[model samples]
Target: MSGPCSRVDHMPSENPFDDRLRVRATEILRELTGHPEASFRDGQFDAIAALVNDDKRVLVVQRTGWGKSAVYFVAARLIREGYGAERGPTLIISPLLALMRDQVAAAERAGVHAATINSSNATEWDSVLDSLTGGDLDVLLISPERLTNPKFRTNVLDVLLDPSRAGVGMIVVDEAHCISDWGHDFRPDYRRIGALLDGLPADLPVLATTATANTRVVTDVAAQLGDNTMVVRGALSRDSLRLGVAPTASAEHRIGWLTQHLGDFQGSGIVYALTVSAAEDTTRALSEAGWNVASYTGRTDAEDRARLEQSLKDNDIKALVATSALGMGFDKPDLGFVVHLGAPSSAVAYYQQVGRAGRATDNADVLLLPGTEDANIWEYFATASMPDEDEAQAVLSALSEADAPLSVPALEPLVGVKRSRLELLLKTLQVDGAVDRVQGGFISTGVPWSYDAERYAAVAEARRREADAMLEYEAGHRCRMRFLAETLDDPHAHDCGRCDVCAGQWWESGVDDSSTSGARRILSGIGVPVEPRGQWPSGMATIGVPLKGKIPVDERVSAGRAVARFTDLGPGQVLRSFLADGAQDAPVPKNIADWCITVLKEWEWEERPTVVVGMPNTTRPVTCADLSRGLAQIGRMTDAGPLSYTRDPGSPDVNSAYRVQNLHGAFNVDPATAEAVDGQVVLLVDTEIGSRWAMTLAGRELRKAGARAVLPFALALRG
Candidate 1:
């Protein structure tokens, strides 16, 4: 796995660093850092020289805080200056908007004007392009997804690649590890970079940089960079980071530990959770404990995410409870600590995330509090990135048969894959040359493509191996720092003697009883509001459902309540195990029954339900009926029994159109139940709400059968 370059290794330049280029790059570096004494780190100048002086491709694998960004910022300025008035702006293909914003600011400090085009700043695309063409920009940053945008490809990219024009002076790939499927965070759009490189001039300078990437990922990315690629690899050890793991018995214990020990960590930091619900729940728990914190997850709006990131940087809060959405490209010089509520599936991912701490600080604490449910969460994420062959074929076929390009919404009815998965599949197909994203949407390129079943299987097996490695990490049998360094294939990996096992446990292990009780109180509280479906899914008519646009007011289900979300900390963990796939059905547990009644009592609605009715549950009939009967008896409402399914409603895992079609006319209201619900509000009970299509359809049936309104109540709501 060794590359041409090792720690402190460099390619012999045909000539020593060109004196003029070196002097100019140093000036830019000092300006960027606001430190007149700042100079390039060991191999930073080598990488810049390779690109600017030799016009060669370069790959840099350095640890965090190693000045990988400095290499590019200096190189971009030098290259633009080399070409004089005929110069073209340097092009940077970044992975995240946060990273882009950081890079843009750094570029400005270096006196290099820069701009970005991304989804967030769509209206600014024309102005950015104007700056690029007018030679008013030194660096232009765009995401990999921008390459798939038809307009950008035709107008901006084509012009940038044209040699006859003032094409780009150099190309930079930030977070380059994402280009490889072998990497921990592989993104399909990154595969398009290979094509982009192929279109560029052979002598054009290019540089790819990342803090995370094993030997395999390095080899893959280097190959994608084409021949004669200079590799500048460095030791992957963070001297300022002290690593440790705290084994947790349950969700309550994990929350309890955070509530007690979070305030002890120095300065502001981040607390990572595996899921959005968990992050938000932890934020609430910590805030209730009188800690100043906020939640940052994928569900947070872009504007709020920006605000929260700024708040954390300004030390306005103690911590930000977050998921992986806060993982990459967030820079905080003095971030004091990073704690994970659950272990990530791969050591590579854990290293990348924990790298966010101790960047410029003298020391930072990094700890992992592993839970029993971590494995289940790992399994869910392991397969989420892989492409499904059947879903791929369905999307490709739909595009092939369309007269014109079909938007994702239009193809939803023809293909049964969920929107997120379907979009991922399309990007994979686009990389494989089987499809093209056009003006309206997507179009098949008519390129013959076969499912790479073997490759996908290999990726899945690799995921399992990573998961096993994570389990070993949680065991604490060896030095934690050495384990991560070795896992990333760092040749200098050695026992750091700074970890919990290398030394004695440096922090308190026991969580106080009061903290545990507080965690229990926070976790056990019930009543998650269930926002009902307001409009029928688009293209429902194409599936023969005859439904379109806003649902009728009379037939709409009222906003309701649930005992808890399936991703909640305490009750959610229990519900996850109980409702997991292939689990046998049983009557509602006594504790669950009490929780359901508590949720009902706490729920404040516009109109209270007068009757209880269970949705048809072929899988959990006993549990559904028990819930309906218990709620009716406890709340003094009439029990109307369970509704009957006219036929099997089929699988609910498909897309909206297909899922709605499967349940459109599937439920029936019996004469006795219909009469009993006359002019009355009904409480519809179910074991869980996934797509919520079943509840919507059933509510419509009840409304037609003399019910004035329907309120959905469930044990859990699946994200």
Candidate 2:
């Protein structure tokens, strides 16, 4: 949220009046009737001066609210200051039509002669192109897609490459991050930019800039721009903001949560949704809920988007729900919050979306409501259905033959697929390294000999698995902060205990312990029985025996004793625990104990007779005696198995039991079983269940004197 550091703080305090370069620059600006103060200060003047003095090319990058446009505005002014109005024009490649208009408006306001060469300029484009070649215009802004057109490129190449036009003062590549495949808002045409730069002089002083780039993205951008370029990184952190997450079960809950939290804070805010429909729905819902709101998406008309953005700036709307299309070139300082209703596909998208808020350093909040369905949606899109190899090859061949970068509409008929389907196919191809898109059309990367449909399928499956792993992390039993940090590879250790999953309130309250344990018993009963051979005792006695039409239930008539009976109990009635091993003199609950023993008998024969009680909050069912040995074994298994936590609660006696729980749970069960019992408890014994470190540790003290099946207990929720 904080603005850039003041230029005065980074520079010497000598008066500009005495500095010859500064005075001359000011005088030249005054002669040109430009706003010297507006174009200078905040390190802009210094950067521009350095660019002119060294005649060095630079990349000036900024995010949505970082005032990236101002860099060019000042650069153009300084260029005129150094080399009078007769200097050859600076070429600007505008990406979007709307951006062209905005740039032209700003240039007009600053009294600079700038014209855009786009489709919208009917006769005006021709005149401007001619003037640019004739060395008449001061700055020429054209879309990069236009550079691919033979005629357009030829026309501009002549003037810039003429040797008479000073070979272009500086080539600026705006939104340079778009060139990288890893960027969230990638444009195929962006890749062609490197080729465009190739046509320019190697020493043309190119300046490539963008607002956001992680380390990987920055490296990609620098490589795309060629090496030996000066890289300037402004502040990446925005401290005047609070980052929080609001996890919910559904979109409805997300909206509800937003309304509750945003009630008191009233200012411009942007709610970014994954889909256009979601944005519309959220905007409509907020409006109906009495908050003034608007919606923007790629489908929205350019004019409407402009009006809505202007309205937001003018404070005409209190809030706006939009897709990523709305933020690029938008600068609204009073934005109170930026809320994401669903998780973005990647961290880059997240950083960009949240970066919209708190531009002026005032307090702002970034709320992320990553719903349960977000991961599934991301997987669906990330692993979208692809085209057949033949069709893919055909499309690529067609694009290669195209004289210009063809738009979706123009390319759809050639591909013989619906526009939407074709777009996704192209995206998939790009992701798979089969093709590269540059603006409107794509270029084949030449299929690798190793490429195979089965391999692609395998890769998709891997991505899905990774996505599933991330979802599990999101819904895991440990601290949410730790999960996020580990999942995203965040270096800093965070201890926020505020996330819904972290609090464990929902799981604790809604978990049907009875059903969970009951299901486990049923599944274990269906498992193959193990038989033991030798004097080690074939199998321990089980509680029930299969009888006609029903399970013959075994009940204890007295302490450590049992009798066969058939009966049914009411829902809330307490059931007895079935005896698996050890002293028959120990007291155990009659019905529940019988049921546990019955389930165990179904799964065990001679080989390891044991029953597992799936108790909520219970770590693992395995039992181990040696504390240090158990801990060591658990540590090894922890990385290979589903995440398990060791609960110490600080009491020495309790801590020892906790350590056992951690070990017993990690390595005793099959991978599938370990996943199911990840954050829950299991019950088993040593001799009957074997002395496996993990198993023994989990079931240790729980199988002692009066303990029955390591009953994992929880406070029953009261309505």
Candidate 3:
């Protein structure tokens, strides 16, 4: 098997630095670095020479801070100069918007003209294209999504490919591991690159670079690039990273340890969580402890994400509590430390994330505090990666049966898959040529496709192995660096002199009570806003409901609250298990009820509730009733009784429209309770809010029954 260190030599170059291309590359590198005397590192010169001089496809799998960007920028410049002005600018298929922004700025600093044409710069596309066509740009950066966009592929890429027109010289695929299914962050859109590669001429030099590819990823990526792809690999170890793991008594130890010891680390760094809710909660805890920090997740707005990233890089904050969404190409050199709230499922992924730190500085710390619930999270993501053949067949059948194309939302109820999953499956099928996305959503192309059961099964099995390996690493039997290196198939693997095993545990094991208390206070005290439904979902009429347009003010609920999210680190883990499918139905546990009370007591409502009412469900009716009664007793509010539904609405797996239709007229208030709630602010309680329609309909009933206002509350909000 092919690993990063496994090299396939191409046509060799004569006089490595004597040629004009090499000299210019060196000069360009110097300009980019702002160091006039700076020179190329090992394999940097070779990779640049392979692209610009040898005219060969190349894969560079060096650790972060290895100056892979220099190789590509210099090669693009030389290729543009060698191919002449009539040809198109060298195109780069970058993975992230942040990465593109950084590269674009660096290209300009290197005096190489560059422009981007991704989603963020949609407004600038007309002008960016003009510059490329006008031969004013030397480098063009774009996301892989743009490569598959029909309009862009037709108008921009096709035009750029023509030698008689604005022809192309070279292409760069940054974060190339994304091309492999074996890659931890495999993206379907990045797979579109194979089509782009096939369309390019045989002589066109291509380069793929990544810092996290294992043997499987490298082999898969190389095969995609075809024969004669030169591999330039480097050591995975970062001497500056002092790897260590702090074994904790409980999963909750992460936050406490972070709260107490974050300042102990040398410089501002990152605290990574597996989920967005965990990151946000961690950010809040750190900020509450007077440690300056911000939450970074996929949900963070584009502009705000950009601003937060800058703040972290500038060291204005102690750290950014972030999820894996913050991974890949987040350039922060001189980062003081890297800490994980929980271990990632695969060692490769863990290494990739920790690799972000200590790029420019010496003696940066790397710590892992594995959690009890990490295995559950790993299993969830593992299953999510494997496509269900039954679901895929359902999607294909639905599309084929339809007379016209159906949008994601339109097809949601029909296919019985969540919108996000459905969208992903459609993209996967589009890649398989079973469906095509046209002007108005997606339509079936009548292409017969096999399920490929064996392939998907194998992928699922690999995920299981990765998870097993991650568990062993967390157990800390061997050197952490050695374990990761061996896992990644890094040929030069050995026990590092650092890490918990070799160094005999550097960080403390037990967390202090003060920090632990602070964590409990924050975790138990936290509650997320539940935005009220403002408008009726479209296609409600199709689902046997007459509702349409914005919901009237009186029928709508005020913003509500949930005691804790399923992703919260404190009671979230316990609460999740407590709320699981086969979990015994019982009254709300006193401890959880106490936390719920804490959430309500801390919630600053405009009008305090005087009454409490529960939404009954067969699954956990006792819990729901107890929650309402427990709150009513503590707050000295009256128990206004349960909202009665005429019939079952089934599970909340249906779309918003179906959900609304199912619950719209199902809830009702009895005469005695209708009189009891008159002009009183009521707290509407439920064990969980899945569709939110149940709470919406219940709140509407209470409002119509002369309640002054309805404030919805739930133990958890399922999305």
Report the alpha-carbon TM-score of model 1 versus the true structure. 0.76
TM-score of each: 0.76, 0.55, 0.76
lDDT of 1 by residue, 1-719 (tens): 12243223543445566687778888999999999999887788888887887788889999888888888888888877872224588899998767888889989999889999876555466778888778788899999999998999887888787778778888999999998888888889998998888877768898999989998899888888887688888898887889999866787888988899997799999999999877877887898799999888765544456778999999999999999989878899899999999999999999999999999987999989888889998887777678888888888888889999998877877897766678888889999999999888899999999999899998898889999998898888899989999999998888988889899688888899998888877667877766677776654554467887788999898987888887677787788778765577887888888888788877777888999999988888887888888889988999999999999898775556667788888999999999989899999999998767889999999999989999998999886
Error of 2 at 307 (Å): 1.2
lDDT of each: 0.85, 0.51, 0.81
lDDT of 1: 0.85
For each of the candidates, give the backbone clash count.
Answer: 0, 37, 1
lDDT of model number 3: 0.81
Candidate 1 clashing pairs, residues 3+ apart or interchain: none
Winner by lDDT between candidate 2 and candidate 1: 1
Rate residue 150 of model 2 by lDDT.
Answer: 49
Cα lDDT of model 3 by residue, 632-683, tens digit = 9989999977888888875575445556767877887988788878998989
| Model 3 poorest ten-residue lDDT run | 1-10
TM-score of 3: 0.76
